[model samples]
Target chain A: MRELSITTEACDTGGCPVRVVRVSGYIDAHSFPRFEREILTLVNQGNNRLLLDLRNATYICSTALGLLMSVFRQVRHNAGDLVIAGMSEKIANIFNLLGISKLIQAFPDEEEALRCLAAAEAS
Target chain B: MTTRRRDLALMVPGEAEYLCLVRDLVTTVARKAGFPDCRIGEIEIAVDEACANIIEHAYGRRPPGEPHVGKPQAIAVRLALFPDRIEVRIRDRGRCFPPEMASSLDIAEFAASGRRRGIGSYIIRSFVDEVHHSYRPGRGNELTLVKYLAKGVPGG
Candidate 1:
């Protein structure tokens, strides 16, 4: 089994102010602590705009989904936004079925999510 | 005519950290039970959620200031693969899950509530054909999940 990890990089898209968080491998209760710490560190660092890349992530338990929601809310609280991209169809449908899709914006890829991050911010 | 049946049992300490191993075994069993790849994914997720609840609710996450009771409890799962349905039973002795919690949940209400919890039961019921839980005084709780095979699918 692969280990879970959260790594980051900062990129500016026409002054859009975006931070990319790439999550991979299995993320469950055991690994959620590191995941939460890294994301909150960014939020507390004032990097509000975020693009989450989950193409490589294999499994995301409910705890992880909740963590994502927490981060999304925190970002919005600071007048910023977050969009996720590259989820497997099955994973995306889980989020959709739970209605998380209604609150969080998701895209097929990072590029599309980036293109619409600002637009989604209006919601 | 006679058909063959297969059953497997696993017992692990009631804790969240061991779910990764449980998911792997469940996926393997589901795959061998003739479930499609997509269905296997659903089974894996549903079982993970079920076990997570057992760890969190049954065993109770060591309260902030309280010490654990000597050692954590144990949860056991039994998988029975038949020609008609794949049945899984998870048994725990720590605490009994409310019978109603396994019932269908209102997605809209859950969303509006802004809560991250309570979605596991829904997922388990959604992914499988049927879910049933039984409890006995001080005996234990058993949560059974069943996924029916498609018509014409061979199990024997």
Candidate 2:
């Protein structure tokens, strides 16, 4: 079975501590469990400021997008923030088409997403 | 059991538009089978999830191509209506699902995470009354999903 590689790190943003997770792989039905596990682990740890770097994702389906929205709702309920960054145009367009961008903040890069999340938390 | 019903199959391509087509077809079929709006919506979501999995994972990221030796030009979604239930089978000649990978998933973890990310099969199982998977050595993979339409079920 092909594995999805997910790495999380603490971002040094000036405001709240943001956890940036970079995911690289096919985020389809097969590999979605791994992706969900990593995100839930971080969320359970109170790492609400999430920056998903999807630049390396080759494919994403509606199921994957639905899962992201579920996570976003969970974080929001906990009064935390979730952000996505570095998504390819195709992935970004998918998010937009699904109206996910309206629910969660998306940025062009990790730094910008982290900065924005920090700024929002500070204000 | 002698009630005659219609069956239709559409080749779903990897393109995203096919998702909508499948959704519309499933909704129409469910409605014709006497399912209410909410039930039809649930069935549509389940079918969409299944077709999306076929397009994205079964076929990988390959673009639309001619029907090849082992690869079909589109994923075939077959629907059969019975007197009291509906059976939908999705067949694909692409990559078969690995048992180990399919078995490793934890549905509780998915529920806890509240992430709808990878629970296509789970969704299918929950929405439908029965779900089955089989693979013939030379025939490829087949997923059979059945939903019973009982009277007074709020949507039947």
Candidate 3:
């Protein structure tokens, strides 16, 4: 398959705007710049409530993780939030081991994460 | 009968595009060595981080007056499988990574700092049981990482 592919979708749930970004393949140092660019472009365009879908993503290097955290901080700064969905157990375990799970919430699938984020935004 | 130990070696150019090959080799061998899926995943990341570091911190950090600006470098990775653990040694002829900078910052603090680098060291440490880095004047820089199998895990 490809080294990395990122696709985004705009969704409005309960009057809350959320963008679902689906990533597949490996996110190593080579592809991280593109990943960062895509996220930053969306954020700059005011699409900051991001639900990152990693169901098909096979791997994520630490630098990419760091960039995710950096982007998360930026989203929060803009009064928005970033959450994860449909990540493999391996990725989830890695996040937990690195203390990233504590800062970001992950759900089993995109629907659940979108629902929760919408609820959280509505409240 | 005792399980035979296996030693595997690979040499890849120090470039980001070849990292997937390294990860695939390490994980495939780890699985055949009887490592559980989770442990295999950890090994994959550790080895990937080491090679990626070689690509970035080692070869990427060249001096201003360096002559071989675009010269290709290679990373040598050796994987030895024992009855109780797996050991990985990655060697490169580039600058030695700073030992003092190997520690991980709090993820939140790191994110807030807006820094995109430095987390590779943390992932390497967190995934492997032991880590060692040594540099030789004529040889190169070698990083060794070990991850012990859990009790009762079958030998390779």
Candidate 4:
């Protein structure tokens, strides 16, 4: 089994706190539940603005992708946002093929995503 | 690639922990079959999605993160390499799935509908060139996915 690690951090951007959840490894059916629980815990705690750092994540199955879409809706409904960064072409291709990228904004890296989210939160 | 055919087969317990092993096997086979890096990635995801579906739905396992109290069943995976394409056949004794329902839906609408599942079929359909499903009363369900090495392969 591929190990999936989810570590979270919060950056106080003066307007809203941008929570960064960094995940590494395969987020397949076996691991998505933990991933879901971690993210939902943050959301339920009022940490809505999120940056999903998938830079180290090698692969994400359909189940996990579907969960992200659902989470995106939930975050938006709560007046918060969920964005992703550091996806390889392989991962990005899957997102594009499924149209998930169309709904969830993805940046090339964490720095760019943080900047964009910070700007949005400030404005 | 040559006209000569090559084949590979694997049977693993229907558990989420073995999903990565399936992906790794597919990747190794695909690379050896001469698929490019990008196409190889697509094939890996397609096969992974299919096997995941079998483990979760066919074997009656609970959703992710939940334990399955029942004993795990066997998932048989067969790969055939042809001159122009590669075909993966996954077999399980679990319930049958409607092949007609494997269309790539509008992701935005599906997501907005608040549905969590039904994306596995979408991924399998989008990544592979063709999907064929058949089930027998006692022979179990077989789902075959084909991917062409190039864009214009006949029937691909």
Which one is best on TM-score?
A: 4
Model 4 misplaced regions, further than 4 Å: B62-71, B152-156
lDDT tens readout by residue for model 2, B31-134: 89998655565566567677766666766654434243554447788899887888888887757863122323444454456766554554465556666888
lDDT agreement with native, every candidate: 0.77, 0.68, 0.82, 0.83
Local accuracy of candidate 4 as per-residue lDDT tens digits, B50-154: 888887677666665556676668899999998888889999988875444455478889879988888877667767888888988777789998888875121
Task: List the lowest-lDDT window of 10 residues for candidate 1 chain B.
Answer: B147-156
| Candidate 2: stretches off by over 4 Å | A1-123, B62-72, B98-116, B151-156
Two-chain DockQ for model 1: 0.39
DockQ of 3: 0.55
Error of 2 at A10 (Å): 29
TM-scores of the models, in the order given: 0.84, 0.52, 0.90, 0.91
Q: Residues A1-73, candidate 3: write the lDDT tens digits.
A: 3689999999988898899999999898677778888988998898879999999999998878887898898
Q: How large is the interface RMSD of each prediction?
A: 4.1, 10.4, 4.0, 2.7
**What does candidate 2's lDDT look like per residue over A15-122, in tens digits?**
588888888856544466677788878888887667888878655555666667777778878888788888876566545534467677788888788778878888
**Weakest 10 consecutive residues of candidate 4 chain B by summed lDDT:** B147-156
Cand. 3 Cα-lDDT: 0.82
DockQ in order: 0.39, 0.13, 0.55, 0.57
User: Could you give me the TM-score of model 1 versus the true structure?
Assistant: 0.84
Candidate 3 TM-score, true structure as reference: 0.90
Model 3, stretches more than 4 Å misplaced? B1-4, B61-71, B98-104, B151-156
